[model samples]
Target: MDPVRTGGLRVVRAAVVLCVRAAPGTVALSFVMMFVGGVTPVGLAWSTKLLLDGITAGDPAGRNAGVAGLVVLGVLTALLSHVRRYCDQELSRRVKVRTQIELFTAVSAYQGLAEIEDSAFHDRLRIARDASEFAPVQIMSSLLTLASSVITLAGFGYTLLRASPWLAGLVLLSALPTLRAQIRLARRHGEMIVRASPFWRRQAFYAALLLDPRAAKEIRLFGLAGNLRTRMAREIHAGQAEERAQDRETLRVDLGLAAMTSVLSGAALAYLAARIAAGHGTAGDLVVLIAALAATQTALTSAVLDVATTGELITTFGHYIDLTSRARPQPRPVAELAALTGEIAFHDVWFRYAPGQEWVLRGLDLVIPRGRSVALVGENGAGKSTIVKLLCGFYAPVRGRITWDGVDLADIEPLELRRRIRATFQDFMTYELSAADNIEVGDIGGGRGRADLAAAADWAGIGETLAGLPRGYDTLLSRTFSDSAGDGGHEPTPGVVLSGGQWQRLALARAVLRTSADLLILDEPSSGLDVRAEHEIHRRLSELRRGRTSLLISHRLNTVRDADTIVVLRDGVVAERGDHAALMAAGGVYAGLFRLQAAGFADETVPR
Candidate 1:
């Protein structure tokens, strides 16, 4: 067997196993019904022949018996069809749910961001998700249908062979070309879908942009709906072009196969007519020959179709198997992370986003001593975020190592290491949940009550605003959803959206809610606040930082002037490290940036 065919068989087997495990009773019942359904048509054909012969011979009892048998079989077949349909739908639903859950679970288990950040992986993921939705069930259904068709073909073939072996052989042989054509078409269809996925993804992106509330404001402001619509249409056209070409090829091949079968049927009919004209065949023989010839062709065609459809479905489902089967990197033998008693140190760390990319951090060495606040100030693209990601263990160093106290970060369990750290990122999430729920999300497993949530909100300077909402802490914080569940039979109100600064404050409350965290990191924590609000929030943060190990990254020099140690990052290395006054005296990059920002605030012009 061909390697591709062998792989397809394996996928088919896996699909069978998955469906059986998902709903074994449904699978067994469906197959049993299919078998009965397959044999019913054969029974109907034989009964029609018996009825015709009984009428011709004036046998009234025989004709009546044939009529009764036909009626019973017809009703049974109809009932079986309905039951089979229900079973197929139930099996499909169960399998879809199982596959989707397993798919996402595997996705979430990925221990690194490298694969998640990959563009090609995104395409594969999208395809795999689509395959998960239907492929397994479709493959199983097709396989069962193929088996049913085979049973039908065997019965019809026996009838035809009894009438004339030559006719039966010719009818069976005609299906070979169709079977070959359908296999080719299936392969082409699978390839076309893979080729067109990128276009479909882009089309989906444009479609989503048109519907997104965030983009709606900018789109209307810039008058961009027409341009976006045009781009979306272009992607649709690109993808459809591939499909249309394949469809045309499929049509041509089908027409040729149809013509061949039609010619064979005509020849068989003429031969049967000559046998009857020569007085060598009875009226019943004529009826049986006509029915069996047509039935055999139909059964063979149906069988070929089921096989083709199964092949196509298996080809697509292979993507899901490939994605889920990929082995995750095993963790090295390491102990649980210990408390941060001494310092977090980066020793000669070097990193790049990918191979051949420009290095983001080059031979960088830094440290945050225990119970001391360290503020990292840098210009944009000075690797501030990269360092944060590295420290959070989202990525590892390309060459050097980071350590907790003296133990290498790579030697500590990732989950255990992260549980001791808390950070309010510059790009923190603003969840569309209740105000209290948003804060609670930060330390979900911490089991804190509403009072603890309120305290954290107060620490972030957002307690009063949240408390003033109509439903207090339970109020939904988004305009996207309405509070439709009424209280006391009264009409409910809609939720409200917060301002940027308010959302920022809420995110801060979320991070601060994790009071047990050992190392606190604040990245531009007051960037969205007004002047007075920023001043007030920074004062609270300064107090929060007192006698605690913290790392702060801020572009505002005034905010870090009172830190225990301020580190200036320039060219991916520490340019200066000391107290604010010491760095200002040194008058290096940090001093120049501070004076420049001060000039802007003092209403004095500064040369570029």
Candidate 2:
């Protein structure tokens, strides 16, 4: 078998299995309905022929029986049509729900950012999402249609063959070209969609920018609306151009095939008319011949369409299969991971985001012992964030290893390793949820009560602020849903949006909620605060980090002055490490940077 055909068969098998598992009862009933519906047209044609013959012979009983059969079959056909539609809709809904769950689970359950950040991966993901919505359902529908068409074609073919063997052979042979053309067109359309995905993705990005609240101010201030709109329009036109070209080709091919079928049908009708004129056939035979020819053509056309459509859908669905079948990071066999009680050591570790790229960490060696605070100060792109990512097991070292106590990080399961650590990045998220949910998401599924949330908020110095909101902790923490109403008798009330400092405090509270975490990582925790807020937040942080195993990253030298040890990084390596006072006394990179920052606040009028 050809590879493409084999792959399509695999897709069909998988889709059938998925549909059956989603709604087995509905699927079985739908197949039964389709089988009955397929033969109804043949029965109607035969009844009409019987009525015509009986009318010519003056047979009253035969005419009445034919009329009754026609009435019963017509009504059954109508009812079955509607019932089958209902079954198909229900089956589609169930499959959509199941496939969507599986799709996102495969995406979210991945342990690293490497694939998620790749552009090619995102294209596949977008295609997979589209497949998730309709691919499996469509495959099942096309299969059912094909099955139904086969029955219709067989019944009509036999009738036509009995009436005139030559006409039956000609009609069946004429359908071969139509099937080949449809499959060829389907392959072209599938390829076009794959090529157009990047354009569609780019268009989605620009469209999102137009609606994003964060970009609204800058867009207006810079007069960027027109430029962004033009870019979005360009991408849309690019994708549509390909579709229009495909449509033109399809129209041309279909028109040519329709003309050929018309000519063949006309010739077949002439032959039958000549035979009847020769006294070899009756008016009843003419009616049956005409009906059989049309019915056979319709059934063959439908079967061809079903096969072509299934082929196209399977191509799109291949992306979903690829993503879901990808090899995920296997979990280590450790039943339970031990708490990080001793120390974490990074030994001669080297890493880069990609091969052949500049190394972000070059043979870097560091350690953080238990019950002590370590502060890392570095310039931009000096690998401060990279270290945090490596520590969290988001990526692995290209050379060397990181160990928790005596065990290598590579040996520990990523999820289990991360469970022992809590981190607050400089670019933390401000989730649009209720105040309580915003904080509680830190230790998700921990079942912590409101008291615990409030306590964590107090530790981050945001307890009073959250409690003072319109509905206290229950109040929404976003202006986006200000117009949305609450449950019960509560009417719409404007929700509040936190200021930068307040949002930062809320984020800290979130990190604080994970109190059971063994190692704490805080990256620029007070970067968004004002002078007074920063001072107050650091005061709270001092109490929080005291005698705790914590690694802090900050640019403000004054804030890290009280840390147990300060490490200054330059050129992907630790340049200096000591107490703040000792580093200042040494007059190295840390001392120079601290003096430059402190110089801005010097009292020129009094002290100078």
> Which 10 consecutive positions of candidate 1 have the poorest summed lDDT?
1-10
Superposed Cα deviation of residue 447, candidate 2 (Å): 1.6
RMSD of 2: 2.3
In the range 168-277, model 2's lDDT, one tens digit per residue, is 88899998999999999998998888878888999999999998877999999999999999999999999999899999999999999999999998888888888888
What would the per-residue lDDT of candidate 1 be over residues 79-191, giving only the tens digit for each residue? Answer: 99789889989998999999998888778767668879987777778888898888988888787787888888888888788778877887888888899999989988988
Q: After superposition, how far is residue 448 of candidate 2 from its true place, in Å?
A: 0.6
Which of the numbered candidates is closest to the native, going by highest TM-score?
Answer: 2
| lDDT (0 to 1) per candidate | 0.87, 0.88
The count of residue-pair clashes in candidate 1 stands at 0
